[model samples]
Target: MIVGVTGGIGSGKSTVVNFFLELGNIAFYHADIEAKNIINSSVKVKTKIEAFFGKEAYKDNVLNKKYISNIVFHNPESLKQLNAIVHPEVKKHFKNFVNQHKNKEYILYENAILFETKSHHTCDFIISVYCDLKTRISRIKNRDNISENAILDRINNQWKEDKKLLQSNYLITNFAQIETKNQVNHIHNILTKKRKLI
Candidate 1:
């Protein structure tokens, strides 16, 4: 079975992914890693990005992420165009990954934008991690060392908790590790016993 964990920036999705990894029952796919690899590896995507933003999009085989982020975050249209180019490539790569793991009981598609690109449709269940707005901004500032405006901009781009909660089967408010562990364990029981995964 495939389960998805997604949330807005600084919502503690990564911590939840880590907790699942510690359980040894799931393989986690970090979409950011896959997206970056695709951008760097796919000739078609590379050409498109370079065409959209010029050679400045990359430097010496490395993505100029900050440069790209600054451009997209400031302009909604640019961000949409960028997502249109990258999301399909990332989804295709994810499909290939799913094909190889048919026998696995559970796998995770951890993405911050699961709903944005409709990737959650591919999963059997989804968990939306959440925290209040103040908490989220504080966490992002501390963890990523990003400015408040940048963090707020990213949060604005993500789906609101109200909408995500409606779509998600599970919701976790990760204020602490123990709380996260408990939520994951609950989901584990449901997946293993109730869902009858082998």
Candidate 2:
């Protein structure tokens, strides 16, 4: 089964994904990493990005993330155009990943914008990680070393918790390590019990 685990920016989704990694029962595919790889490796995508955002999209053969981010965050149309280019490439990459791991008992696709991008529809089930906005902002600041305003901009672009909650099969609220682990275990138990995999 393909289980999509998603959450907004700074929502502790990675922490939960790590817990599942420790269980050694599933393979995890992080979409952002794949998207970066696609952008850097695919000449077609690179050309398209440069055409849309200008040569400033890349510097020294590396993605100039800040330059592109500033444009997208400040304009909805730019963000939509960028997503249009990136999302298709990422989807094709994910399809290849799933094909390669067809024998795994379960696979986990972890992404920050799964719901917003409609990527969750490809999965058999989904888990939504959540936390309060204040906590999320604090986590982002500590993890990414970015200003609060930058974090807020990313958060504002994500699907709201209420919207994601409606589509997810499971919800995990992360506040602390202990609570996060407990939630992971709860979901693990449900998956095993329901599938009779235990």
Candidate 3:
């Protein structure tokens, strides 16, 4: 089975997924982190991004994240074009990763935009994490050290919570660490039992 965990910015999907990571027999794929790595390490990807976004896209072999984020967050077309360059490579990487770990109980695919990228279709189950708006905003502000407008821009780029919940097989309301970990343990037990019957 392939299980996915996703949520909007600051929704604590990472914190929840970390608990799942502690469980046995489940491989993990962190899409955004891999995508960033691919963009940084692959010469083909570097050339493509530089060609479209210009040399400013990178500085001394590292992605100029602020430069790219500023452009893509404000311009939908730029974001689409950027995804077009990076996603295919990440998909290929993920395919290899899944094959390597196919014998495991399941793969945990963690992504912030799993549904937006239509990657949820590849999952056997999905957990959507959510928190109150104020909590999310505060978390992002503290973690990312960005202004509210920039944080909201990232949030707005994602699908609404209502739509995500509609698509999810599980929902995790991540308000506190202990509560979140308990939910993860509950889900992990359920998934463990689920695999046995398969």
Candidate 4:
């Protein structure tokens, strides 16, 4: 089964994902990272991005992420256009990952925009991680040298936390490590048992 896990920027979703990784049986596909890999490695993707966004999209055959982020976060249409170019390739990459991990009882599909991209439809279960706006902002501040406005711009681009929670089958409210791991453990137990019955 493919289980999708998503949350907005700096919501500790990746931290929660790491807790899940501690469990022995699960396989993980990190969609965002894979997308970056695809962009760097695929000449076709690089060409298309450069064609649309101009040559500033890459430097020395590497993605200039700041240039792309500056373009996409503020302009929704540009973000959509970029997703159009990358997401199809990501889907193909994920299909191959699924095939490789076919024997695993569960594979975690980690995407920041799983629902936005409509990739959640492919998941058997969905998990959304939630953190308060203040906490999320603080977390992002530590991780990236970004202004709150810039962080909010990224957050605004995603579906709201409440909206995502309402749609999710599972939720991990991340505030503290001990409490967070408890939630993860609970879900891991449920999915593990779920796989057995299947």
Task: State TM-scores per candidate.
Answer: 0.94, 0.95, 0.96, 0.97
Best by TM-score: 4
lDDT of 3 by residue, 100-144 (tens): 997998899998999888889888899999998999999999998
Give candidate 4's TM-score.
0.97
Better of 1 and 3 by lDDT: 3
Q: Comparing candidate 2 with candidate 4, which one achieves the higher lDDT? A: 4
Off by over 4 Å in 4: none
**Candidate 1 structure quality by residue, lDDT tens digits, 1-198:** 889999888889888988888775567788988998889988899999999988999988777999999998889888888889999989888888888877666888999999988888898899999888899899988988999999988888888889999999999889988988999888877876744744
User: For candidate 4, what's the RMSD?
Assistant: 1.0
Q: Clash number for model 3? A: 0
- Worst lDDT 10-window in candidate 1: 189-198
lDDT of 3 at 29: 94
Candidate 2 regions off by >4 Å?
Answer: 196-198
Clash count, one per candidate: 0, 0, 0, 0
